[model samples]
Target: MNKSELEKEINEASERIKTRQSEIETEIDRLGEQISKFTNWAWIFVWIGAFVSAFALIYFICTNTEKGFGLNLLGDFMAGTVASVWSLAGLFFIYVAFLGQKQQLLNQQLEIMYSQLEVKYTRLELSGQKAEMAEQNKTLRRQRFENTFFQLLSNHQEIVNGIDLKRVRDGSWTTSAEGRDCFSTFYERAFPKGFRLRKHPIEPTVEKYAEFYKVNQSDLGHYFRHMYHILKFIKKSKELTKEEKYNYSNLLRALLSSYELLFIFYNGLSEAGKPKLKQLLEEFSMLKNMDFELLINIEHKKEYKEIAFASSEERKKLLRTKK
Candidate 1:
């Protein structure tokens, strides 16, 4: 009970109190960490429960239940202040489901678009093939026409080369002196006069020419037949293009040579042969259809003009004499 003994006892009690206070603080910190971990785990349970309740609500509606039993159960489990949080979680799940359905609809539309593209491409390919086939057929027909034209050229070699009437004077009518003199006059007159043959002659002028010459009729029949065949071939081929007409005209021009006026005046065989040949020549003479004025220009050239007539006056006089 002295003063020193009382001070020693109070100091020891103060040390013990300080140690107990530190231990209590450390235990409080550990408890706080455990409570935080439990709170995080409780959030997982809340999300799982919310999703299950939403799915149950959907199932009940689908099954046509009389009462909203699943919704009632959810309300009982998550009541008071926390019910609004659970409702928001259910709405979030519904929004996610809507997004999934929208994506499915977009995928279906894309597939339809792809199918349409494939069908369109196939149709285009078929159309191209048909066009190619049509072009090939056209080419074949054109080739056939060209081949037939070439064969026609080969068949009529003599009349196409031109007949020298002067050389054909050994016939029966030219045996007598009077016949020979008449034939000589006819031969000289026939050149420029025969060049004026009609494009649309109604009758064969072979009989008239032969009578004028006092010669055999057969002497001029070959020439008329040759010209007739050429015209017949042209008229029959109604599908001839302007180019083909021009080409055949050039061939006829070659046969006629300096006798450019022959086509304008020559009479051929048969009534059927007359007007058709006339119309064909008229078509050739057209400015739009052909460059036939060039043929006239060719005839007017020095060499052709000199061979047909020595002078324009002589030509006019000879034409007048014939008329």
Candidate 2:
């Protein structure tokens, strides 16, 4: 063949190769499109599986009613209605629970708003009442301070004199203010400074017993409550092994002995003093499973008779002063 004829044949072959490459790229693009379509529809399989599961579960529960399986028009219109009702009820419950929660949140928000409004009104009333007595602002501030001081004093009166002269010289348990007690020492150890006591008397606002009354029974309430807690602690602690419990009980006995002074002071003769003592006695009597005698006589730590030793005269005196 001549040179021109050979060139013409090569050009035709190159054109055919280009056409085949374009066709192959188009086929790859078509396959990629098919993959994307399948990915989009993959969620259908999940729903289909979930629906089958739900159907099976409902069927099994219904079939296995206490009376064995029933059939031959078993899935009648009534049965379908029952199934639908069951499904709807389940969905309805979920919906209702969420709505109830939403309603509770709304109620809580409303309560907060009401509380703010009440506090605002109370402040306004106080401000109005005190404005005329503005001249005595210093006295009011001082009274507020005194009220806190006396209130604290009454609460802590059970502590008696907590002065350990040796510790005072050492400055270990000593503070800048009045002497501290064992309870106070424990309190500071357990918590950070300025944390308030968990419990308080019922009448927080009554600064003192009214009308020329001496603060005779300062620690009466504190001691009574302190006894109750110690008893409860003993009861809970007894759940440990017998040996551990016995050891712990010995420690508890010592603590109770330390607190006996408070009990005696309560039982002493005074109107306020007598009533408070009676309450503690009543509380002590009602303590569940706390056989004070059982605890005291354990392994003979010199059976300290004073812990439970209440005389008949003291009992009679407490009993005589009734409501």
Q: Which candidate achieves the best TM-score against the true structure?
A: 1
lDDT of 2 by residue, 1-323 (tens): 44444435435644554465355435544544554454434444444445655675577577767655454344453355545555654554455455445544643554454344334333433645445333333333343333333333433342534323234556455454333344334323322232223222322211222111232234334554554344344344423443343333344333343324322322322344444443333333322223333221232212222223334344344446642
Q: What lDDT does the true structure give each of the candidates?
A: 0.44, 0.39
Q: What lDDT, from 0 to 1, does candidate 1 have? A: 0.44
For all candidates, the clash counts are: 5, 2
Please give the lDDT score at residue 80 for candidate 1.
37
Q: Please estimate how well model 2 matches the true structure, expressed as its whole-model Cα lDDT.
A: 0.39
Q: In angstroms, how far off is 145's CA in candidate 2?
A: 38
Q: Cα miss at 54, model 2 (Å)?
A: 80
The CA lDDT at 154 in model 2 is 37
Q: Tell me each candidate's RMSD, in Å, in order.
A: 48.5, 35.8
